[model samples]
Target: MKPSAFEYHRPTTPEEAAELLAEFGDDAKVIAGGQSLMPMLNFRLAVFEHLIDIGRLTDLTGINHDSGSVAIGAITNQATVGRSALIRTSVPLLSRATPLIGHFPIRNRGTLGGSVAHADAAAEYPAVALTLDAEIETLSSAGRRTLPAAEFFIGMWTTALRDDEILTKVTFPIREGRSGFSIAEFSRRKGDFAMAGACVAVKVDNDLRVESCSIGLFGLGSMPIRATSAERSLVGCSIDELQVRDVAHAAVSGLESVPADLHGSAAYRVRVGATMVARALKSALEEATDD
Candidate 1:
């Protein structure tokens, strides 16, 4: 099936995109990589009268790193992000998660902002953002605003972005100490959506005690679940098998509200989620110790 007829507007700048969104209101939909949106449009799941194409907006096309954080432009392709040396060194968690997003061809066209905006429960970018406490920046006719990842994702396929706002970039803090990052997901095929996944970022001190830790779970809830309870439990604990198991249990304990679907039962998802968390934590611990 093809998308219904719509008025297409190619905006060269983010300001122009914001104006188009404000002019069209709810009738306007922004298109970046169009990987997710095009599928929804083709399936008739989403219909809009106006399509604002921001694919050529040079303002939203690069990755910039500073002393404090790394800012990734909204329209930057996933492939570019995955291959970036800056991201690999500064925001390694994001770099590790990018390859797990989709196949090479899909990543070539999928945008980082598109994935975050789409808010797919099983998407890698959102989970990474949540784990890293990233900030999302948006532009609108009223001006600009930044939202933490925790507040940006409201629900499944939902976000705090206003109708007249266009997401311009995402900023992730650079971990300053010895840090390790790991991503683990259970997918039926290489490019398929995950049944359960975990993203772990951990910083350990000289004594191997956790200085800071962030855990984000995907494919287990309405949105990416930041396993804060589990993180708190491991903050001062030594990285070991026993501590990892306990942390995994704490993370899964928050899955009391996860809904079951055709892929797995609630019980199965919880189990898989816990196992993924354990694996991720162990891998992160190894990397942290090595670092």
Candidate 2:
């Protein structure tokens, strides 16, 4: 199916894009790589009167690192972020999770900000952002504001971004001391969305006890739900297989309401969720020790 008729505008600057969005209001849809939006358009799930293409906006296309965090431009492609040496060193979790998004071709065209803006519950980057407590920067004619990951994702295919607001950048805090990060997904195939998945970030103190940690799960809830119970379970515990599995089980307590789509039964998703969480935790622990 083809998308309905819409006026197309390619804005050279974010301000211009914002102006177009403001003019079109809810009838306008901002597209970057067109990886996600195009699919929705083709399916007729999204209808817009004005299509604003912002991929060519040079202002929104770079990766920068600061003393405390790394900020990636909204239009930065997945492959670029995945292959960046700075990103690899600053936030290894992103480097590790980008490939799990789709495939080489998709990664080449998919933009990080676009993915976050689209806010697919099962997407890897959103879970990573939640796990790392990343911040999303939004721009509008009014001004700009930064939103924490937890507040950014409102629901499935929905975000805190307003109609006139454009997500401009995503920033993640640099892991300070020894850290471990890993992702595990239950995809039917390499490029498919996960039936269930988990991303874990762990910081260990010199004593080898978990200083701080976060676990984000997809295919478990309406949005990427934080495994708070699991995080609490690991706070003082030494990293080990049994401990990880136990915490993973604890994480499933409040997620009993997961949707049962064509991917799998809710029960099967619970099982996969448990397994992915455990695997991600163990992998994160191993990486922490190696570091």
- lDDT of model 1 at position 266: 88
Q: How do the residues 108-164 of candidate 2 rate in per-residue lDDT, one tens digit apiece? A: 999999999988888999999999999999999898999999999988788999999
Tens digits of per-residue lDDT, candidate 1, 198-251, equal 999999999888999999999998889998888888888866534677778789
TM-score of each: 0.97, 0.97
For each of the candidates, give the backbone clash count. Answer: 0, 0
TM value for model 2: 0.97
lDDT of each: 0.92, 0.89
TM-score of 1: 0.97
**Candidate 2: Cα lDDT at 47:** 93
lDDT for residue 192 in candidate 1, whole number 0-100: 92
Runs of candidate 1 with Cα error greater than 4 angstroms are 240-242
